[model samples]
Each structure stands twice: as C-alpha cells, then as structure tokens.
Target: AVMDFACPGLMGDLTSFRKIYAAPIGKAGERGASEEEKRIGAARRAELGRLTQGFIHARKADEINASLLPPKTEYVVFIRLTPTQEDMYIRALKQKSLQSMLGRCGKSDAEAPTSVLGVIQNLQKLCNAASLVEASDEFDIDASSKL
Candidate 1:
C-alpha cells in the first residue's frame, strides 16, 4: 500500500529513510546530532517497526476472515439540470462559429486557432461544470454533477 502522509522516516522503512533524510538534517543542524538525536532516532525507528508489523498482522487477519466480509455496494446519483443551464447548453450546440460561443469576452479572430481552442475549452468546461466556464457571480457550484 502507498503511504500518503508526508512525514519523512515515519514508515516501515524507517532506518533507510532516516539515513537519507533525518541524518542529513541532523548533520545540517548548528552543532550536528548529539547522543540525544541518536536516541530519538532509535526510538522512532522501533515505534515505526511495531506499527508496521501490527498493520501487517491486521491485514492477514482480514484475509483469513474474507468469507465473512460483506458484499460491496456501489451508488449512483442522478441530478437534473436547471432550466437556464439547459437552455445555455442547447444554445452552445447551435452556435455557428467559434467567435459566437466565446460570447463578447474573447477577441480572437474567428478563423484563428486560439478562437477554435477557446470554443473547445469552453465546451469542455461546460460539460464538466458551468461554474468552471462562467465567471459571473451567479454561476452555481450545483450546476454540474461532477462537482
């Protein structure tokens, strides 16, 4: 399993990680690491080993009890688009050119690649969420199911 926490030398491979990260930090400190630092490092390494072994044991226990595990369930939620949002989506499909879909904000020439890209980007943003494409204060976060 991948560990998401960012604490250096805090995983099962504590000694190796400490030798790479912690030891360097200790050496970089004003007077370098003293006996106290060594003691702390050893204590931390032992603690990590205990925790890692415990996690392994727990996972093994779970595997042994797999026959008693509950069946997994998946959920799907449906949301309807608001009337105004639906109108905007339909109007977006009927636009004749890139310049039109960009509204009055984009000033790129109609035939320019930037204008074409802007239209595509706008469509993508709309499909993902209206709030992502719309800069107006009235844009709602609830406008898209992906949110």
Candidate 2:
C-alpha cells in the first residue's frame, strides 16, 4: 500500500528539514528564547521580488533586513496517514479477486498450473483472516463475541 500527504511549507523528508533549518555556529543550543526573543518570534515568511525574501510582513520588512539571511528561529510541521487510509483505494479494486483471476490467466501448462487454483483458496483464506482481524479491532461488531 502507498500513502501520501503534502504539507507545502513542510514538504520532503526529515533529513532535508534539518538541513534547511539547522542553526549556525555560535548559536545557543536548545535554548528557549528570552523575553526579548519572544518578541522576535512573530515574524513570518513573505516573498520580496526576485532577489530577496522576508520572514516578516512587508510592513515589518524594513525592520527585518535581508542581512538576517541566516534565519533566527525554526519551526516544523508534520503529517501522517495511517495504514488503512493508504490501503483503501487499492482494497476497493477487489484486489484478491483480481489476483486470482490473473493467476489463472497466467498459467501456460497444458493442464494449467495446479497452483493457480490455490489463488482462489488463498484469497478466501485472506478474507477470512481479515474478517477475524476486523472483528478483533471492533467491539461494536456482534460476530466477534460469538467466537
């Protein structure tokens, strides 16, 4: 199963985020900002023509010079999609049935491959197991209680 999510500001993977936002030398490590520092945290990024950018609003851009090229602070955003959501689309295609159908079609033996028949058997097994697994995960399902 494949799942995907995009957070524009926080695109890409873990390694890249650290590389782009890591503090330079002589900076204090893991140090919370002072009260004066707290005042500085209000800045946000904005585009400023072709050559430059600002992390503060245009109104505040004059105060936040481009010389502050080394960013003063960093923040991160993360997103995740769980296994079921990832699998939902593929699962909708009736994957097990299709697999069995293909397995049967692929057999070239004169008698046809005996293992192709196993595809249907295995598909049934998978469904049975999945139903049991779903039963375990859901208390509201009455079927689980009987077993």
Writing each residue's lDDT as its tens digit, candidate 2 over 1-147 gives 011142244323555434432322112233665644333332211111211323223456746665566656877754332344235334734677555556557556553455555654654443434452233445544333245
Please state the error at residue 82 of candidate 1 in Å: 6.2
Global lDDT of each candidate: 0.62, 0.41
Measured by TM-score, the strongest candidate is 1
Instruction: Report the lDDT of model 1 for residue 49.
Output: 66
lDDT of 1 by residue, 1-147 (tens): 244254434454757667754564455453656776666666765665675673444457667667787876799877666665576778887877643545644455555666667777877677556666668887455664555
TM-score of each: 0.30, 0.20
Off by over 4 Å in 2: 1-107, 110-112, 131-147
Winner by lDDT: 1
Worst 10 residues of 2 by lDDT: 42-51
